[model samples]
Target: MWVERYGPKNIKDMVGNEETRISFLNWLKDWKKGSKPAILIGPPGTGKTTLVHLAADELGYNLIELNASDVRTKDKMTQKLGPTLSTHSLFNGKSLIFLDEVDGMYYRQDRGGIEFVQELIDSGRVPLVMAANIEDDKKVIKLIRKSKVFRFRRVVPRLVELYIEDILKKDVAKLSKESIRLIVREAKGDMRAAINTAQSLAGLSTEELSSVVSSRNLAYSLKESFEAFFNADSQEEAYKALIASKVPPRDKVKIAYLSVINSGLKGDTLIKALEKIGEADKIVNMIGTTQEWRLLRYLDRLLAYSLFNTLPKGSVSYSEEDMPWNLKVRMWNEGKVLKDIGGRLSKFLHISSREAVSIFMPYLLVVIGKEKKSLERFIRLLGLGESALKVMVKESERVFLKVR
Candidate 1:
């Protein structure tokens, strides 16, 4: 959300954390592999995620990200990611592996998880990143010993004041020096928290600001996916977002193609969109096999399509909610289930997703009602109860009534 709003496309828009950001960028640019991963440790809301994404985004490197909850089992890490380490690059040259929140990973039943990840580091894939808050744990200290550690200090009040003043222009806060000092005091130098607190307080009257911070309730904004596809500041950022989205590259291409078409793109715009997706498909195909993992950089091209392929100016207005993430996730999962069903039937007949949809589905509908046992798992995954199944498949309220 902040990137779409406040992010600097280049180096100039950056506010604080100058020294660390610069050093990090320089390290990525100069990497020769075989080097240990780098760690960025900072307090919360200090743009640690943003910084990692920004660095990779600016550099055009593919990012494979893992967070704390990701299956960090010893067997899983070695068995799966083990090859990516020694094999090839995702993008022609090198790709970045980002393991955020590693400070929290120390000891467990799977004590070998951290040890195995270190083994991959020896294989020379490229740079790896780990981020955390308060690097006090013994495990974190051990990991820090293996990598260059960059500290992101809290943004000072004067720097925060400058940044906010530059953006908002007018004094939205309109506070006396005393109140400003109190806010600064309360902020503890985290500019992001301060900015957020200010945004929430802006809508409140003088009486409301005295109570508490309602702003800390802000959720991590969902705009990263959109910005990744629509207006990423850097090629690296765009590519990393697309890869991290976990949607297949082909589907990503298809979605972008449809978005452009839906935007009422025509003539040369239509021509360009088609060409872009065509190139996107080629890139996807190559990246799918290259193991060099280059399809990531091509994401910028996809995002460019989304950003420029909007409905022509004055042709259509826009709203904040194009579609909710929850709804999209559901439909996407449904589509996948449909694909799985289709794939099963396609294998039976030796054909494609299209063939299954066009031909096999009709047969299933007839036989499915009689022998509905096969559909139990899919129906459950779809969260469809007996009534929903009857309504959708049977079109018979009577069937539902009988079951009830």
Candidate 2:
């Protein structure tokens, strides 16, 4: 929550990446129809997505944002983003389309997603911005070919500490210099993680603080989880390690799969490990579909006893695959807003909230923008306050651009 609470309000307020931020702003400012879309590549917590949102707001552009969690099937991408790319804004303001975590797409889950995006970039009437942590990913490489790519580096420790200090001051919270330094170092140049760590340390006694920081440092990393599973000398050891792991079961399966492939397990061993991983993946999917949380208890055993046993006994180090805290916080806030809007619109339109969002809202926004009398009437009827009505009008202007 602190990540969102203290997120930069404008482009100039963003910490670190000053030159890259300026370049990004200039890219937006000088953008014309059919200009190459810019891809902002960086490590997690480096403010890539934040830069796009802030720049759009400050420059008076209507922002249309999509994330990896959204359905990225070709049809879905085309349906949701195609019009926004082709049309001009009704209010004469520019529109910026932001796609976050483009590297997360895969051939199976996001069939044709990259191709569709490439098509859009070639012909889009507005600038498109995308963020990815892995710039060299095959899919990302393809996107980069058609994009003006900017690499965002990690925030230096000193800057992260200063940012944390500013936030703590605002909250009237106190922390020792040593404690702050430890947090910044532990965060490894991740500003969001550093802030979150500081927030947890707030109000703790000196004695409690040291222990807490120690425990946080001991918390399992993804690489360590892989090592534990592969290097376990016994089934019990593997089970204990897997159970104690902080990585979610779904991600554990992915890590195991990647480890097996990367470990050079050959012929029968490779086939067997992949089979077990596939089975574990199925269990994960089943758990998700049924909400049968009890099944989760078996996942660690399946992964450890069956899949990991196939691997040679040694450590396997892999990069962390967890979603960044900043993005998680942003998505949480965005989801809440969408849910509220859907509920309000559904109640007024006598339709399901899902229908209100997927079917009615697009047309409704255009109508609201084009017909001021109707907008006023709807505002009064829906009990939308002046500020809310203004937001609606602003969003509607973007919708009208697409519809027109």
Candidate 3:
């Protein structure tokens, strides 16, 4: 993999977070018994682990690294580090004890683990360095109170671009400026991910590039995924974030539409973003109606390339609270009504309920709008409830006017 093959070899070779790196190096160099342990906190792929590895190499300290998340219980942690707490290596050399993924350690799962670490710190037996993807965890908080904390920010875009350009120069790959921008923007300041993405795109044609970018193996939490999608600088960047997310396609579309509406976007930007989303919705509906799943491939491009220029960067963020409580309740009630109407129509028209909603409902509403008496006739024939009929009427008028 390019990430491994092209990984930074030394402290100076690493990108971004210069001051923190320097401070960490100084702490390692000035190490003594009774000194405070240090914690490196930042997002993933920002060189937290890499820094420690390089420091160990440069300083001649044998690194004894443990993943705190994996070493769940205190017993496991003790067994791993007990002998080496203040001792030399098998070679009788000094050692550095590094605990990584500290944020992933949970009190319940890693019972007594954080306390054991505290004990280690108080003992002040050896120089210790810890790394975490976030600092908000309770276990991490306990460590922070006693440790000197260093923060690492995401690598800047220009540095990432320069890094990749040098790599391409050596590898003799000829990717376009546009394709390189896609990889860089999509990486979102993750140096490791940037290298991996560039490796994936190194030899692909333009037609095949979209698939590679869309299918890139990125796993983000729902909130993270939505934020990345909405905050994307280009439509392609947003779409890549969307498709790369593990979110289900239907939920992805719903969230994308909801985010666009609530994002506070204005004027032509709002209109264009919504227009692209609407096109995506139509494509989603078409796939639902035809059961031709292959059409799903087009959604990424339709959303990304089409809306890239209009949706402002950092204009949208994902929050459950972004949606008003009243609107949510109304949507829930309306969904039940729509389900009832779809169910009745499914049986009446000998079609699936999904088809009834995705393909037939708009036309049915248009028909009822044109001929008022048809509403009563159809309601009786389909056994539609009064509440269902009211919803149907309201939806029909909305659909009718939209068509006009």
Ten-residue stretch with the least lDDT total in model 1: 214-223
Residue-level error in angstroms, candidate 1, position 207: 4.7
Q: Provide TM-scores for the models.
A: 0.46, 0.54, 0.55
Candidate with the greatest TM-score versus the true structure: 3
Q: How close to the true structure is residue 205 of candidate 2, measured as C-alpha lDDT?
A: 88
Q: Which rank order by TM-score, best down to worst? A: 3, 2, 1
**How far is 240's C-alpha from truth in model 1 (Å)?**
55
Report the error of model 2 at residue 267, Å: 37
lDDT of each: 0.63, 0.80, 0.81
Candidate 1 regions off by >4 Å? 1-4, 7-11, 75-83, 90-93, 109-111, 170-181, 210-404
lDDT string for model 2 (159-260, tens) is 998899899888898998878988897788888888888888886988899888677666666776667767788988888777776778888888777666
Tens-digit lDDT track of model 1 for 32-125? 7677778899887566777778778788876777777777778766665556566655436556888888876766844787886676556556
Runs in model 3 deviating more than 4 A are 89-92, 203-207, 210-404
Candidate 3 at 104: error in angstroms?
A: 1.2
